[model samples]
Target: MQIPDYMVVPSLVVVVIILLGIAFWARYKTVGPDEAMVVTGSFLGSRNVMSEEKDRKIKIVRGGGAFILPIFQQAEYLSLLSLKLDVSTPEVYTELGVPVLTDGVAIIKIGGSVEDVVTAAEQFMGKPTEALKAEAQEVLEGHLRAILGSMTVEEIYRNRDKFAQEVQAVAAKDLKKMGLQIVSFTIKDVRDKHGYLDALGKPRIATVKRDAEIAEAEAVRDARVQKAKAEQEGQKAELLRDTFIAEAEKEKVLKIASYKREQDMAKAEADQAYFIQEARSKQSVVDEQMKVELVRKDKEIELEAKEILKKERQYDAEVKKRADADRYAVEVSAEADKA
Candidate 1:
């Protein structure tokens, strides 16, 4: 179950009236920014405070709040932000007593001690601009000259690293009695005449540095171009070599084919020689057989001639014998008749 809120109006009225009665005891509040409790008298050493006077004082320097009395003395407002005093002096003399044109920078906020603050307040007290400048020229110039004389331009230029220490050292001794601590001091205008810095010829250095960059870029571009050309030439050579190798391979194939043909032709010649030799041997055998047949035919003819001559001689012999017998018989018959 939800419950409703109750208002205690009678109790709240009593609490408000009780708080208003305590308002007359007198609380202190800094109107602006004051962080620390105000200690009365010179801030260098005294911590002595009357409880009555404590409520009357406050330190109002920067952003924040602190306690103070609603009555008696009020808090003083000192600006805590960075401040500068631009100075131009003409009366300063170097250790060489050479007159110079000088400019100064005073980086300040607030003094650390009451004694320091009192000195700064008295020196920078209310005056017209012309009078203040005149006083700064007379008093501050010598102090600047003395400090700058101990250092050179090189030292001053490089001294920006520990500027606070240098300023503290230079201004601390004098301004300590015046209740001020300087953050830094800067000397701006050091004139060596218009021609002095130009006489060093720094423009040549800049020109040389620029020219070096251009030369480096040019060299890199030229190298890349040359490298690309060399790569192209190498590729061309490789291509030519490949073409030559292909041509050589083709020539080798042609030579191999021609060699094979020559070998075939040689084998054909050898076969022709073998066949011719076999034919000549066969022809010699046939010629021998023909010569033997011719000799046999001539012998047969001679034998036949011999047989015909023998037959004719035998017939003639028989005829002669018969004629001889006839003659004998005639003679015998004639002789017998005579007897």
Candidate 2:
């Protein structure tokens, strides 16, 4: 077909734009967070990798995008994500000559440093993550067997953390050469055919039971002793109260008896005084009557003596008169005879 001269320049411009867009899309590449983009082939000079080995020629891109030249550079991806390994060992004899089986789990990954990535690219660039996991698990199981042979069954069973640490420490140096790191390693279970562990716990259980019985007996004895002491104190208090009451009653009785005795004595003395006064009054009346009788007897004797004297004087006078008359008559008769 014949093309127009003015249309050829515009068509050529449109074809160039479309070719450039396709080339740009094909050259641009990106890697995610869990992927490492490895670029290998001819380079201008040493770049994007930190490896001391001159023979390894590779560039690693992680977590970003890069433009790849089509002919000189080929892009390959390596995994940066962690891998889990189930590590187990067959029955192996320990240091104590006891056979044991051990099981464990481990987490491993390719190291993140530039040197580690470069080193890993040389060894494992074409392997899958599952192939990496199998290779790491084999190394771990080998170290676990070596550790078990050096330790006794009791040491491995009782101190699992120590056993795991020893295994990790020993395996790290060998794994580093392959550009792998041990994120974590732990022992899950340990088993033996003979019953050695159960026999070890029996003595401690017997001692604990003995101590509990002794403590209970001592508590009962202490409770009984406290009850007896309380009863003794109660009895002593009652005895002291009874003694005080008896003494108070005795004092009351003695005081009442003494007061009654004093009252009887006072009454007896009053009666004696009244009787003595009455006896004195009767004696004074008897003495006055005897004096009056004595005075009347003396007056009667004086009157009788006066009457006897008057009668004696009258007898004497009559005798004198008779004598005088006789004398006169004698004288008269003598005179008549003379006449």
Candidate 3:
């Protein structure tokens, strides 16, 4: 078949556009939040490292996108997600030679530093996540066993947090080499084969039970005695209250009687004073009347004496006139005889 000349240029242009789209899609790679993309091959220069001692040619991308050429570089991922491990140790000997069984849980993850990512890429490349988990579990078990061997059984059982902390701390030093770390470690339980813990609790339990019973008995006895004493005190207080009330009532009555007597005495004295004042007023009136009567009698007696004197003078004057008339008649008769 012969190709048309007018269609060749447009078809090449379309082919070029499609190739560019595919190249853009292939070169730009994106990683998830909990994932690290490690690209390693020729032409990858030295990336960020922790120290000058370690120089590695690798590019680690996490939580973002990177440009990766498809031909010369190979890109792989190591999960940054946590790995949960169940660790169990059976018939482990303690520092005091006591054999115990212990169980625990651990949360582990690959370190996120640039140097740690490079280290982890070197150790766990081309391996499954389960392989990483297995390595972490072995390391945790070894450290747990070693720590338990160094402590007593009491220390392991009672201070489980301390035990877990020591184990995690000691294991972290070793795991950092493999670019792994422990987020948390917890002791779940501890057990013994010969019933030592149970035997240790029996004596204390019996003593506590006995003491509780004794305390209950003493409380009952004391409660009864206090109840009796309170009742007796209540009765005595009631009797005293009655006696005091009776005495107060008697005193009130006596005081009322005395006040009434005093009021009556005052009234009698007021009546006597009124009578004496009336008698004195009556005596004063009688004395005034007697004085007026004596003055009238004296005036009558003086008038009677003046009347008796006037009568005596009249009798004397009449007698003197008669004597003078007799003497004059005698003289006249003697003169006639002589003639």
The CA-based lDDT of model 3 is what? 0.86
lDDT of 1 by residue, 273-317 (tens): 989988988888778877787778777777776777676677677
Candidate 2 lDDT by residue in tens digits, 1-339 = 999999999999999999988998899899999988888766625557543457757788899977788898889888888888889999988998988898999988889987778777778888877777887888899999999999988788779999999999999877888889999999998887676655554565677788778877887888788778878887888888888889988998899888888888888888887788778777777777777767766666666666666666665666666666676677777777887
As for candidate 1, its clashing pairs are: 28-68, 55-69, 116-178, 116-179, 117-179
Evaluate all candidate structures by whole-model CA lDDT and list the values in order: 0.56, 0.83, 0.86
lDDT score of model 2? 0.83
TM-score of each candidate structure, all chains considered together: 0.39, 0.56, 0.57
Ranking by TM-score: 3, 2, 1
Query: After TM-score superposition, what is the CA distance of residue 65 in candidate 1 from its true location, in Å?
Result: 3.7
Clashing pairs in 2: none
Clashing residue pair totals per candidate (backbone < 3 A): 5, 0, 0
Residue 131 lDDT in candidate 2: 76
Which regions of candidate 2 are displaced past 4 Å?
1-14, 44-47, 50-55, 201-339
Error of 3 at 28 (Å): 1.9
lDDT of 1 at 60: 27
Where does candidate 1 have its weakest 10-residue lDDT segment? Answer: 42-51
